[model samples]
Target: MVRGKTEVRRIENAASRQVTFSKRRNGLLKKAYELSVLCDAEVALIVFSSRGKLWEFSSSSRKLLGETLGTCSAAELHELGNQLEESLRQIRKRKQCILAEQIAELREKEKSLLKENKLLHEKFKGGNMLHLNAAEVQSMEVNTQLMIGRPGTL
Candidate 1:
C-alpha cells in the first residue's frame, strides 16, 4: 500500500501535539542510535521540547544507559553495576537530607502555631464577656433591614 506524506504543521490540539512530538522524538533518537552502532560513528543528538524539557542521545553515554554491553567483560560489567549503585546511593542520600530539612521546618512551624494557640486560649479563658440585663437587651434591639445600592436611594 502507498502512503501519503504527512503535512508539516503544528498540531492544534495540545494532547495530539504532545503525542506526535513524543513519537517523532523517539523515532529520531532511535535512528541516531542505529546510525552510531551500524556505522561505528560517534553520534550526539540533543532535542529541546516546547516546554524546555531536554531529550539527548550520546554514544558515549550508552554505557551509563545500559544500552550497549557486547564488548563488556564480566569485570567491566561488575564495575558498571557498582558505579550505578553508587550513583543511586548518592541520589537517595541527597533526597533524605532535603526531606529531613523540610520535616524540621514543619515541626518548627507546628511549635510556633501551638504556642500562639495556647496564648490565645489563656487570654480567652480569663473571661471578658458581656452580661447584659433584661432592660438593656430591650433598649438595644437589633435592626434587621437589608439595604442595597446607595444608602438613601435604595
Candidate 2:
C-alpha cells in the first residue's frame, strides 16, 4: 500500500527531536562527503545543533583554502584593473560630450534672445519719440493760448 506523506512540523517530544537532528546531521555530512569525492570539488559545510555543537566538513585542508584563493596571478589582477579604468574613461568622455552639446544649444538660444531683444528695443524707441513729440506740441499750444489770455480752451 502507498503510504501518506508525512507533515514536516516541529517534533514536540525532546527525545524525538534529538533523534531527528542526529539522523539529519549524519545524512547531510554523508552527502557532502560523497559530493566532494565524486565531483572532485572543493566543498565546505557547517552545521550547528540545538545544544550549540558545531559540525563541519571540508574537501581540503583548512589551511589550503587561503592558499587556493591566493593563487590568482598578478597579471590577471592588473588586467582587471585596466579594464575598470578604461570603462571609467569611456563614461567620462560620454558625459563631457553631452555637456558640450548642451552648452552649444544654450549659446544658440542666447543668441536668438539677444537678437529679438534688440529688435524690440529699436521698435520701442521709435514709438517713444512720437509720443515725446506729441507731448511737446501740446505744451507749446498751451503756452501760446496763455500768452493770448485764453485759459481753458486749449
Best by TM-score: 1
Model 1 lDDT per residue over 1-154, tens place: 9999989765899999999999999999999999999999977676889999988898765776667788899998999899879978997999799899879999999999999998887776665313556777678757889787878884
Predicted structure 2, TM vs. truth: 0.39
- For every candidate, C-alpha RMSD to the true structure in Å: 12.9, 26.8
Output the lDDT of residue 96, model 1: 100
Per-candidate TM-scores read 0.47, 0.39
lDDT of 1: 0.84
**Alpha carbon lDDT at 146, candidate 1:** 71
Candidate 2 residue-wise lDDT, 1-154, digit = tens:
9999989876999999999999999999999999999999867676778778889888874422233435557785566467557867997999799899879999999999999999998897876743566657567533352345566656
Instruction: Report clash pairs, candidate 1.
Output: none
Error of 2 at 126 (Å): 99
